[model samples]
Target: MRFFRRLMLCVAPALLGVAASEPLSESFDVSVPQLPQIVATDGGKAVRYELHLTNFATVPLAVRGILVTDADTGKILRSFSRRPLLTHLIPLSGTRDDPSSARVTIQPGARAVLYVELSGPLPRRIGHTVDYVAACETCPLRLEIPAVAVNQAAAVTLAPPLAAGPWAAVQSPDWPRGHRRVVYTLDGKARIPGRYAIDWVGLDDAGRTTRGDPDRAVDAIGYDAPVLAGADARVAAVRDGMVESASIARNPDHVLGDGSGNYVALDLGQGRYAFYEHLRPGSIQVKVGQRVRRGQAIGALGFSGDTTGPHLHLHVANGLDPLKAEGIPFVIDSYTEIGRYDDIGALGSKPWQSAGPTRKSHEWPASNVVVRFR
Candidate 1:
């Protein structure tokens, strides 16, 4: 009920006008049980408690810090605060802030969940509360969740499956010469936020990649896109309401937190997930719980979400939660590495290396050369 009350407060006109006029700050709502209860697991051990934070502000707000303390002693029990992603894509005009600093901006009326995990030996009594303090530009806001004790098994669930494919091998014969060639160039730099791989893929009639200009082949080439299930075991989630937006680089959605305009997340077995972000919104064709064939046409490509242009943001990770998940390396079946930066090594072949001389030239590989996967 506290979360509900906070949600109402966020949309109130007075708060809305202030948030719209000034730089926003951090706030939170707690949904845990009202009465503090003791949680028992493994017959007598303390259960792990997960905390989720919901943002209801108009501008983005960063979660600068989180502190969990013993109510009786006022002693801090745990704390967590840091930017999770290695590479971040800032708007060309936006100010550059500290990387470890909480720079999260929850779009107006939108919601993003921040998670915290707490595990411990059993506490003997109830009536304790966990206090959380978070901040942005101005001052910090405090929230408290009443602790509860319960004897229940934690539920484990699998994430969606990786997009399947009649994967196409597109050619990038004229890829720019450099260690960062595969990376999208923003402000003349290659390291962008989120882990991704780039390669050329021939598009079929049903594929959106074909719509790109071919003569501007370097810009025209499309990735070997895959269609993934939104949830594990079958299709479990689908949203078909949003329409795709035209490609626009670095345009932040003033209306929403970099709207992942529309997307499908498949729950792969075992808490793993595959996220197909920025799919043409409203193009979703699959239904909840419907089993889909591999490489099925779930939707077309679009420029949505926290993106500047129309490039797919692809990754495989341990969970559906972006902030808490670890990005893992993955590969498509096959493609040719038509060219290489003599000074930099192979394309789509290595973790981003920042220490070496940047490559400046490349020659197309032989027509029949097989592209190796990393």
Candidate 2:
């Protein structure tokens, strides 16, 4: 009987159909922030996840396929073959090739980033699990994402920071943070942060962004625009004295200290911080520790930081430091979706079409959609 028990123990795993050998690096790492990082936006019409994939081998790993499915029901949520999956890796930090490039190769010790967004109407809570199959030559991986890890609750709702006027949600969270990278901070410390940051630009008639020539700082319409407090809050921190660059080229060295150049951070209670960045030097009106009210003028928008031009770089995060904190989502009480902008064409020449005059409330504008505040 003792011999029979030992044999059963040995055959138990096989009876349960366990694999005899693991993949080359089946233990390869997949990093995600604490669970329930899932966020809902566009009035809960969308759900997003920022996933990081790391390859810890010496040879290059090519991500050739992907599959996202409902774990319980075996329903396929999303799937990508080699061709489409390659596009997903195009925006990763290291890859420089066009989307037409067939395969995205991850260099040894590098990460392959992916931004996953599932359109709603979705459940308030996922209540199940998601199965992920990332097919690769050297790092093929399969894992499950818990439903509890994704929170579909409403993001923060707040009053519009700027007074009534035309402004462009030039770079907004309506989509992934950058054209591809989902998290707000360039540094990986932030998890699902800055998911909804907005780089706002005010526009004028004649489809011109500035008053004069495009290259001149003074010609930009966003220059000197009044940046207001989005809510009643206390000043948390301030950074000033960084000179605005003469042109739109970003100086990589300044990203750490002056990237947000001459900015104001407001504590909006409940541990939420409102960041108003890229302000003109000496234009800040409130000092740290000062109490401020909604609609109070804080500073003029400027080109002082790591920016393409003069625009309000606004976002909310969990902590005081923008670089370290995870980005949180918020909604403007109301704004009118006025038009769309052509980013590749001459600056500000994008045509404005009537999304109609009707004003929409409790809305979050997507990236590149022009809107008016009233």
Candidate 3:
């Protein structure tokens, strides 16, 4: 009888079909909204992009890790965890920020964005494996994003936006509320126009950002600095005749007109538009349909828009919509790396920490670094 029972157990799967199949439904819908773009950084190359995740399950799903890999070889490229992972995931809808709660969790039917920056040799395509656990479920789940194509389009190479330097190419390194993290959803589309933007904050001979105090707009070093054209192109758009504050405002809420104030947009050919923002009132020298030469003085930087002080906000985008266009990367033709800083206060404290004055070409200056553009 025991032998007969054993035989029945062995043949049960074939005779009565007792074998189980894994569930085919996914817990989350994963997509890459844009192709990851490649930039030639000082250290090899970096892929910059984002992933949009939407919860598919009825309950919440707490994201644990996101693993990026080479699509062809399946080789691991970059992985994120802990605090790094927490800060990168931004919930787009229906979630309150709680310090104690796991910030990576996406509620049912809610969506979140994961900003990813991976560095290495350029991959033909990238893949992703996202680990998460659903509420009211025992087992963890993984969502796979297979074969996202890398954007092969080369970064636009351009001349320096200013004729002089010892200028600080100020792109914030922080992920929290920096230009790189702002994903503006407007007109039914989402894009980050300042992903590669830099605030060209000029400095004086004594290595000071301001001559007197930061409160006075004219005292700021970046004020009245000539905003130069990065390319020989047509003046696509210009916003002029905006009033400026005599004193600097400290982190005030941004309101009024696209937050750019008086500005000039250059059509740099190939559908790329270069923007120079926050010009001094009545300083914009060019108008729409005018031709501009490379290094031409288009305007002067000032505190005309939402700003902590006077500075030129320069960026290249795919469209004319400053808020809705996807920001693209560009490299200055030549510049000397002076050093870096954590904040504006760190500059001129002790000679910029010395980057050895090495001339770098066809490379974008890193965040908060001092550079003398040639």
Candidate with top TM-score is 3
Model 3 weakest 10-residue run by lDDT: 1-10
lDDT of 3 by residue, 231-338 (tens): 889999999887887767654555745488789999988889988998999998988999999998999988887877788898889999678799998888888887
- Candidate with top lDDT is 3
- CA lDDT scores, all candidates in order: 0.38, 0.63, 0.77
TM-score of each: 0.35, 0.79, 0.89
> CA shift at 281, candidate 1, in angstroms?
2.0
Model 2 per-residue lDDT tens digits across residues 1-374? 00000111122343556754343332224555533333434444655555556656566555555565554555656665555566454334555434564556666677766555566444443322212223344333443434424555466666776765577776632333362255444564545445667888878744568777777666688788888888889999988777876766443347455667889999988888999998988899999999999888999888887777788888887889866676766777778776666452544775555465556677667657677776
Ranking of candidates on TM-score, top first: 3, 2, 1
Off by over 4 Å in 1: 1-233, 247-250, 254-258, 340-374
lDDT order, best first, reads 3, 2, 1
Pull out the clashing pairs in model 2: 36-149, 174-366, 193-326, 193-327, 194-327, 209-221, 210-219, 210-220, 211-219
| lDDT-superior candidate, 1 or 2 | 2
1 versus 3: better TM-score goes to? 3
Candidate 1 per-residue lDDT over residues 141-209, each given as its tens digit? 444454434434222221222232212222221233311112223344222112222222323323333
